[model samples]
Target: MLWPREAGKFIASKARDVKINMEGVRKVAKVIADAVQEGKMDVKEFKQNEVLPINKGLTTAQLADWMFLINTLNFNFWTPDGVPKFSIEYEGKIHTGYLAMVACVNRAIDEGKKMYDPHYYSKLTLDDIKHIFRSDTPSTMPLFDERVRVMGEVGTKLIEKFDGSFINILKQVSGSAMKLVELVISEFPCFCDVAEYEGQKVAIFKRVQILAADLWMLFHGEGLANFTDIDQLTMFADYRVPQAMAYFGALEYSDSLHQRMVKEELFKSGDREEVEIRGCSIHGTELIVEETKHVMAERGMDVVGINSISVDYFLWDYRLNNAKELEKIPYHRVRCIFY
Candidate 1:
């Protein structure tokens, strides 16, 4: 199987002949240097407390279920026309897009539904899912039917194969991150994120990899989430991270590609430009991880446990916090479940 780390190295080596800019990478490294010097970038920054639900007191099984459900349905939520995004008011605050989806799931759990249970979700109807994910505002989620279908599919698969628990699958992986990813893609069709480049098969597996990373984060690298090769997982190559990378000068697109993105042109999942953007972003984030470690070493700081997953979280959170500034750059628009 083509794992994410191996795919990053392979696609990046192949992409050097493409029109991606290395000068931009150098500029991003400088930014990383400043962030490290300012003591803003560190693996410890990606704590679960930084997320929502201040005092839910979730168990290990519930947390695993939450991660599995959310990551299975996580995908495109970009609203180019400035419409109100799919949002939910949860815990007295409004969350839009991906966070909103997570909030809704949490809301279901709060309303006395065993939503974390695959057996419960497997029997869910289309309207049940629609109501569960219903937006607070006028804007509804895009690909609503597809999302509903995927929820039922994944839930049923879990019940039939994994004994109605996502934790069972994790236990079967034997503490290997790559094995977990392979298991997810092989068993769950929605998690199969792959592309072909130059007669070579490349595996991005964005959602599956993020699920693994979230497991590691949620468990603090202990229990069922303690994967020995967690560091081997690369960054989740989605649209937002690439935009952040472009803003930080770690990724540059051709003028034609840039214009298309600015105009909100839709690229299919495996289009050449889309693949290049996602692949380059993964490789660029790998570089950022290395550069941040080097800078930490130079500053006489400890760099023992720094990895690509933490770097990805940092970049993703950076993009969210700096949305206004990063919006100045156009993000590639690809409507696919794989992201």
Candidate 2:
């Protein structure tokens, strides 16, 4: 089964063994209620145009190119031992991690490179890509070689199969988010995010789902990016959102697992404990969505627009807004391309 569908099935079968607190679900609902009351919980608040690099004055095609490449290399920015973050200095401003990657791509476009052309990147050299993503500081981007390989793979696939544009790929899906997810994973091996849990394979598809979500947000659910099944996407299962979930008391780790996380222990990809953390976070967010809907309906507020995607946006933004407080909770550490 694909993610979210498989995720929901897993939760149904095993959530009783996981430590999900209904009180925590209600607490998140209250937070959403306050934000809604203050007119701050709008789903538009999470749109990519607000944070995308060089977002102004871009045509729809350009935006699709930018989002495609950005999501292609978005993974594992967390570093240890006080290393400076992966950052890019563009137009006198410094951007970090994912934003920094976008800045670099935009900068490449400014330099007269046809960055959106797969033919351009498919034949790119190591030095060329390094210069494109050059950091402002001595600390380089993590997983440099892997990033190059994935970019090359994506560019080659796009050129060979999709007429060299992500827009073409979107057209193939015909505005179905679930179909897009299936196509992305099947076509791009790098976006394949599967894990084994209790001897059963579980799909996460974190990056691909977020890529779809980004498209939905960027196009405001219209035009070529419109997806009829947009609500099918779950909260992107990742390290940061799980940290927020832990802080909000929506997720609790076993004592042994908590100690491992606090100690900054490294977990191999698909490790049982790591899978549990991510899986539970996905399931817990699903519950929070339900709880929030119930709370809103009980108050005679409209629940027409509420969905897991918007709820996830609220939770992710809440973590960023309260990073100081949430930092006390350690996120499970797993370094992999899946997230």
* Best model number under lDDT: 1
Local distance difference test scores for all models: 0.79, 0.78
Candidate 1 lDDT over 1-339, as tens digits, reads: 456667777777776322445666656656666776688876557433344443577777877887898888888887766787788887787777788888888888788777778788777887888888889889876777778788889999988888888989988999998899889889999999999976778889899999998888777789888899998888899998888888877787778888989899999998877887888778888887787777678878777666777777777878887878877889888778988
- The TM-score values for the models, in the order shown, are 0.92, 0.92
Which pairs of residues collide in model 2? none
In candidate 2, what are the lDDT values of residues 1-339, reduced to their tens digit? 536656645843564334777788889887887678678888667533445644456667767877887888888877664677778777677667666777888888888877776788777877888898888888766777787798899999988888778988888899999899999999999999888776677887889989998898877799888899888888888888878777888887778888888789999988877777778877788888888888888888887667777877777777766767887888877778877
lDDT of 1 at 216: 84
List where candidate 1 sits over 4 angstroms from the true fold: 16-20, 33-39, 42-54
